[model samples]
Target: MGEVVFWTIIRTAIVLPLLWVLKSYLNVDLWWTVSIISVYGVIIHPAVIHYRLFNEKNEEIIEDTLCSTCEHFDKTAVLCLKHDEHPTRDYLPCDGIDWSPKSSDKSQNVFDE
Candidate 1:
């Protein structure tokens, strides 16, 4: 997720300045058309593609792993927030011992009591 965002920012940074430079050379009508197309093709399209690929790559760990349902798990990053580690399908950072169910009501852990 962060990688997707980072690269998107990088692409935007590169594209925006180039577009600004091109604006001075091209007429208003042509610049507007080219700017829209270039923004979509160079910035928006790549970001969307990279985001889809990132989701596809992490889909297994996000859906099939025990960490998916744990409070400490971060689905976007596929990370164990408590342990500050990335969890894989076959590996857990806490080894299930520190696993806590995700609840909207601020559920308490047994150890917290």
Candidate 2:
């Protein structure tokens, strides 16, 4: 997720200035359309694609691993927040010893209370 967001920011940084430069040559109306499409195509679409690809690649870990149900598991980044590490289908950062839920953790105590 961070990688996806990082690259999207990079794409925006590259595209926005380039589009601003295009404003001088293109008419205002066409420039806006081009800018919109370019932003969507270069930044939004690629981010979406990257996210889908990341999800597809990590589907097994995200869905089947013990970390998947842990509180520290970050589904978007497939990371274990407790140890600040990425967990895989075959490995865990703390070997499940440090696994815990997020701070919002209302579900953690559902049965406890």
Best by TM-score: 1
The lDDT per prediction is 0.90, 0.88
Cα lDDT for residue 35, candidate 1: 93
Q: What digit string (tens of lDDT, one per residue) describes model 2 on residues 1-113?
A: 78999999999999999999999999999999999999999999999999999989999998888888787888888988788888887789898798666555656578578
- Summing lDDT over every window of 10 consecutive residues in candidate 2, give the lowest-scoring window: 99-108
Clashing pairs in 2: 71-100, 71-101
**Per-residue error (Å), model 1, residue 93:** 0.8
Off by over 4 Å in 1: 104-113
C-alpha RMSD values across all candidates: 3.8, 2.5
TM-scores for every candidate against the unseen true structure: 0.89, 0.83
Which pairs clash in the backbone of model 1?
A: none
Q: lDDT per residue, candidate 1, 1-113, as tens digits? A: 99889988998999899999999999999999999998999989999999899889989999888898888999998899999999998899999999878884245554466
lDDT of 2 at 39: 90
TM-score of 2: 0.83
lDDT of candidate 1 at residue 58, scale 0 to 100: 88
> Positional deviation of 29 in candidate 2, in angstroms?
2.1
